[model samples]
Target: MIKIDELREGFGSFWGSVSEGWDRLRHTAAGALTRFKPGEQTALPDRGQIDDPLHFPAQSWSMLGGDVFEDEQRLVVRIEAPGMEKDNFAIEISGDTLVVRGEKRFEGETTEGRWRVLQCAYGAFQRTVPLPAAVRGDEAKASYRNGVLKIDLPKVQPGKPTSVNIKVD
Candidate 1:
């Protein structure tokens, strides 16, 4: 037979009771209200928004691109670009998308008394964002302020889907 003192000492005083309370809390109204509870990872991306990123042409990188928001008048894109100038960046639009391409270049020369390291990439990066509908590419304006580049694109009305019905005798 297990003594109460031994049970308390080994179970951290009230572990079993706390575990039951946790299970109850997990199944409470808050948990039952929505079925989108936290779940374990079962497939690639885990986010469920996209499946198998390797199959897609675009690659998602946390250090590459960022969010895009739009308003009634215009669509805006803000990219986090550090240690780059406006001259090194270029923005262009093709079809219903906007493409940003830039190349990073850095060189350093140091003697024995000093050490230098070129940590930034020197190749090139291209990021393309698809628009909701259509945007005026010619009038799209971009500005680089601080370490962010903001692109303002003129927004256009979205197209409506037509309904189809069939009549049978």
Candidate 2:
């Protein structure tokens, strides 16, 4: 006679909530620390606007800005880099880390009155994205259109291994 085994309902999932909470806490700390590395001058943003949670680091993004998606062959990164020109931006990938850097400066003088409202961010900014996997660093391509920077990262193909039988060598 053959016997069937009952499934374990929630063995590992029991700790899922706790583990997820712990990861969020750790990710926040890591993001803060990494944003202040040596020689990397950065500004700590004040409490974000209540109306714009997307401007806050806690809810902004995963260093990749906006939406980042992946597929079997490519990783697509869409960054919100508004108020920038092609020459004012740069995309560089070193090892597993991809860095997007640029500066935005509002030029031109106007003599009307004192400033009443100025909210858009200006000055040097850098966003670093850690790739989901080691990509083909050489074949990465980027393009800027309609105030968005899109990066296409091709996945590196893993070579198959072959087993050879040896008689006597």
Error of 1 at 99 (Å): 0.5
lDDT of 1 by residue, 39-131 (tens): 222112223332433432123222544567866677888877766788868899888877787754433334323322222333356666666
lDDT of 2 at 132: 70
Clashes within 3 Å, all models in order? 0, 0
Instruction: For each candidate in the order shown, give its overall lDDT on alpha carbons.
Output: 0.59, 0.60
Worst 10 residues of 2 by lDDT: 33-42
The deviation in Å at residue 4 for candidate 1 is 24
| Model 1 alpha-carbon miss at residue 119, Å | 4.6
Candidate 1: the clashing residue pairs are none
Over 4 Å off in model 1, which ranges? Answer: 1-62, 107-119, 158-169
Alpha carbon deviation, residue 92, candidate 2 (Å)? 0.8
Pairs of colliding residues, candidate 2: none
Name the runs in model 2 displaced over 4 angstroms: 1-64, 109-111, 158-169
